[model samples]
Target: MTEIYYVEDDGDIGEAVKEYFESRTFKVTLYRTAEAAKESLRKQLPDLVLLDWNLPDEEGSLLCQWIRSRWKELPLMFLTVRNDTKDIVKGFQNGADDYVEKPFELEVLYSRICALLRRAGNPSGQKVISCGTLTINKEKMMVFCDGQEVSVSRLEYQLLLILMEHKGITVTRQSLLELIWDQNGNFVNDNTLTVAMRRLRQKLNQPSCIKTIRSFGYRMEDEI
Candidate 1:
């Protein structure tokens, strides 16, 4: 059965949702604290994560960002009482696949869960991608270069995948931020992108792998 890590602090709501998911044949694991959820995650990642907006220890959005940094393809959804547009945008910026306000109908929630799981199972639907002499499995979230496995932070991998998807074309900073950063069209500082690119180049360790465009954006350097 497909597994989901459901992170919510409220006992009543969590139990109700867990039962709802169970009735639909989904294997559900409940987590009440961010630390506990994160600790369990280190052992093995879940197929999808259902996060709440408010946690006893940390905000749900923060946990979502943490998860995105570690595994980009892992499906994430925010099921919380936070109904504001800002909260919704924050969830997206932090790598959430979808957001549903609390007090949602059980049927609607179930439908959303099914849709997310279905999408996760489809590899062809991925928005960002990467490929090279090195093996970069976007779906599996793994990277291999120079006959050795390379460890990549989630953000770096996300950025590399985005650039690789466009390959020869230039991708702008605004585009990268909108796509990669959990920010919703919010201006991202240059340092964040710079650091991610520098790390990506280091992980690939290819001097001319990524070329910076002067006025517009960046592109992968031509390979012979």
Candidate 2:
């Protein structure tokens, strides 16, 4: 499902837009404040973001810039009542892919969402994955870091590739097993995964990108 985060201070308007998008079969999460939205970001990165120009806790343009710098591939759209050309330009300059002025028809908003998804190459149910210095060829088991060939073991490549594809989001150990081993329940322990991760990091030589989230699973930083 296409997951989207709607960050707006207006409760009523946010709720209404959330309902409208949910009715159209899109997974939408609404936040009343920038603080709340920022908290949600610690858990997972959504496919798209609907940002208001004026947020209570923080300006939407600031948040958009942060997302843009960290997650270079995620799509951000400004949906606000601010309709001035300056505001629109500011939003785009902050790295918004699309902008919609407020008092907009629901149809127009939906059309804009579709267009962003299409432009992101996600309309065909394909994942938009950028990993490490290299983009993983999911169809072909290949690895290219910094535009150079990097040889890795099969297990190491699979584990690193999965983490890279799900960068900015945490992946549980169970999920990792299913993705790499295609098994539901296994006797694998953290040590095994740690070995694989260490080897993968050694091959890539970028350890800061792969982060350990305390007691939780692993998450690749957005800056990567």
Cα TM-score per model: 0.57, 0.66
What does candidate 1's lDDT look like per residue over 1-224, in tens digits? 66788999998888998898888787789999999888766544567889999999999999999877766667899999999999899999999999999889989988897898788773322421334344455656777553356899878777777777777788998788778756334455678888878888877886465788977778874344
Query: Using alpha carbons, what is the TM-score of model 2?
Result: 0.66
Predicted structure 1, TM vs. truth: 0.57
Per-residue accuracy of model 2 over 25-83 as CA lDDT, tens digit each: 98889987877776665445677889998987788999888767755556889999899
Q: How high is the CA lDDT of each candidate model?
A: 0.76, 0.75
Q: Which stretches of candidate 2 lie over 4 Å from their true place?
A: 123-155, 161-195, 201-224
**lDDT leader:** 1
Q: How accurate locally is residue 149 in candidate 2, as Cα lDDT from 0 to 100?
A: 58
Question: Whole-model lDDT, candidate 2?
Answer: 0.75
Reference-based lDDT, residue 211, model 2 = 83
